[model samples]
Target: MDEKTLTISVEPLEDVKRRMLASLRGAADATARHTFASAELMSRTLTPARWNILEAMTGAGEIGIRELARRLGRDVKAVHTDMAALVTAGLVERTAAGKYLFPYDRVRVHFEFGAPAMAA
Candidate 1:
């Protein structure tokens, strides 16, 4: 089985329009891509603590809140709250067994700042 991956990026509105047009023209497949208008917005949502949670969960298999907290040396309540945010973001899911898991086996984050001249 292939490991599913989530791509995170910071892009402008024009890039979004370009991609939409390409998809409409049948020149590209409309794959799911998560984007934020700026890196600051992305960082705000994916905080350092949450990033650690995700790192610990990816490919680690389903894990109960207590166990996940133990692995991170964090409080279960805190982990639970972070888990909820991740779930809402569609980055993680809860199992019937009361475990949380990052559905994707891998995650890719991409960001680039064009030259200052192009920033205009």
Candidate 2:
């Protein structure tokens, strides 16, 4: 199976603009990217609980919510809540039978911080 990755980043507005223009010109790659204006936003959306859910679901095939909660040793209600957020974020998908799953075999989060430029 191909090892798909999810890259998370704090992208500046200019970078977003450039990517938008590239996509408009049909020059953007097919890779999936999740960007946030700030790292705090990313952390809030992709919480540790949600990350655990994603880790358990990755490449695990379709699984019912109860089964997933059992595997994660978490409450069904909590898992369901996390799954809902993940689904909304486009990180998790629901199968035809209403099972939840993550299609990717791998996840790689990318976060970077650069020093502010010195005065010219």
Q: lDDT of each structure? A: 0.85, 0.83
Off by over 4 Å in 2: 117-120
**RMSD in angstroms between candidate 1 and the native structure over all alpha carbons:** 2.8
lDDT string for model 2 (37-78, tens) is 788888988899988888887778788999999998999998
lDDT of 2 at 18: 95
Across 1-120, the per-residue lDDT of candidate 1 in tens digits comes to: 977777778999899889889888888853447778899888988999999999999788898999999999999899989999888877778889888877667788989986577554
Residue-pair clashes per prediction, in order, are 0, 0
lDDT of 2 at 38: 80
